[model samples]
Target: MAEVKLKNLTKRWGDFVGVDNQSLNIKDQEFLVLLGPSGCGKTTTMRMIAGLEDPTGGEIWIGDRKVNDDLPKDRDVAMVFQNYGLYPHMTIFDNIAYPLKVRGTPKDETRPRVEKAAEQVELTQFLDRKPKALSGGQRQRVALARAIVRTPKVFLMDEPLSNLDAKLRVTMRAELKHLSRALQITTVYVTHDQIEAMTLADRVAVMKHGIIQQLGTPDEIYNDPANLFVAGFIGSPAMNLINGSVRDGMFVTTGGTRLTKLPTADRARAILGVRADDMSVHEAGQGDIDVTIYAFENTGESTLLTVQWGKQRVIARGDRHLRKEQDDVVGISLDPDHLYLFDPDTEQRIRM
Candidate 1:
């Protein structure tokens, strides 16, 4: 395993800058994920590290050696792409053994290593199957097995599960996490799916517009986002960003609802951030705000409630069994400790 580091890494295509000056340190054996929406420079960043794309500026280091000028094959890294790039004519065993063969490993030694990798990915039974014969998930497993067989210093995956069905994707997610832990390879995975990043990464780098907005563990990024963008982006229902003003140590929404009375310390902030899960619903009179329920979506264990206070809508998550219907008047309570404050001018987080 090797530690990978990127210092002021940047990439551009003509007038458009795909990746801005971005720097990151990935520790040895760490699972780091690059997460953001489409056109956010995530794949561009990954391609640079994999040597598929050259950076216009900055340096890349694998372990202690600067690898910015190194060829992809010489970088000692294995990459698994989204499309599961397998040779259609080759059998699963031959596909897995191709890297070892290209590197000139003895034929006797290559067989056991290929079989071992296939076993690790539960593809040992299908060793003789061609890419045409395997299912989508199985083809991906072959790709993964091929990457694993190389035993490279670092593993880079760019949304390798995107093509799989939902159920298969979940299974592969768990398998990939386990395989990474077992192999202890330094991994850098890129994806736009927040759930994949949250579940698979030891640390996640949330990016937007070619820049990292936040870098933290799943819980930290979800519970304490660094800015309004992050708070609004990382969650399922997303965080509720109510437009309210602080006046006389209290928070008041535009519709005459007093949601929270902040401490002197928190009162100075201009905006508040609250997560959907942190807010609870009740009858209109007892809580801080009266909202007309716009909709309620039942999501297995919990229900996502969309409530409108005047013209603005906010979501709150609660137990699915707790029933509330459309157009029902409900009271909403905001948990102050869970609330995040942001500066209106900078759109950055403000300490309470």
Candidate 2:
């Protein structure tokens, strides 16, 4: 395994730039995820690294050698794609052994390697079955087994679990994490799903419009986002961004309601971002402010109360047993330590 370095790398198709001039160093044995929605250049960047797509400019170095001219096979990177990319005609054992066979490994040596890889991914029992006979998750494991059959310099996964069901995705995520650690291979994973990126990556590079918004550990990106785009893009239900102003250490809503006291200085206009989990729901008049519940949801693990705060609806997480009607009044308390202030004009974090 080796580190991947992109030096001012770029990709373009006529007028549209898929990847801007960006440089990133993926440490050896690091699991780096390029995360964003579609058209954000995450896949394109991975394709370039795999030699599947030629970059419009800049250089790519895998360890000490520049690999811009190397073909996908010569780059020595194994890719597990979303579709599983298995050969329907071949059995699972053959599929796992294909890479080694193509490279002309001795017949005796190839068999043990194929069996070991299959065993590693828990596919030893399915070796005799064809791709068409296997389930989606099983087929994805075959793809993974195929990739691991060879000790490549880098491993690139393009949303390998996206084709599975939600429950299976979670299961496969755990399997992927286990396999990655056990193999200790340099990996670059691309995905539109924030949950996957947050769960699997050693570090995540959040992308938007072909430019990387921020790159950091999952905790850093979640707790200390760089800007509005990152804060809104990284969460599940998304962070509540309330339009307001900061005056004398207080965040005032547009409707003249004093929501909470901010630690930052006065600002004419600011976006107050608070996650639902960061705000506690309490009985009426028991917390910072009272608001009418717009909607109530019980998600098994917890309850969500969408409350009307001056025309804006803010979601506050309640205990699993907490019950309230749509018209019921409740108190919401914002955790000032977790609240974030962003500049409306610049769309950047205030960092106060």
Q: Please report the candidate that would top lDDT against the real structure.
A: 2
lDDT, candidate 1, 1-352, per-residue tens: 8999999999988989888999999999999999999899999999988899999999999999899999998999998989999999999999999999999999999999999999999999999989999999999999999999988999999999999999999999999999998999999999998999999999999999899999999988988899988888898888877777778778776665677877645344466788898998777776677788899888888988898866678899877787878998888888778988787779998766
Estimate the lDDT of model 1.
0.89
lDDT of every model, 2 decimals: 0.89, 0.94
Q: Itemize residue pairs with steric clashes in candidate 1.
A: none
The alpha-carbon deviation from the true structure for residue 125 of candidate 1, after best TM-score superposition, in angstroms, is: 1.4
TM value for model 2: 0.98
Q: Score residue 27 of candidate 1 by CA lDDT.
A: 95
Which ranges of candidate 2 are over 4 A from the true structure?
none
Per-residue CA lDDT of model 2 for 1-352, tens digit only, reads 8999999999999999999998999999999999998999999999999999999999999988899999988999999998988999999999999999999999999999999999999999999999999999999999999999999999999999999999999999999999999999999999989999999999999998889999999999999999999999998779999999999899999998999988888989999999999999889999999999999999999998898999798888899999889999988899989999999999999988
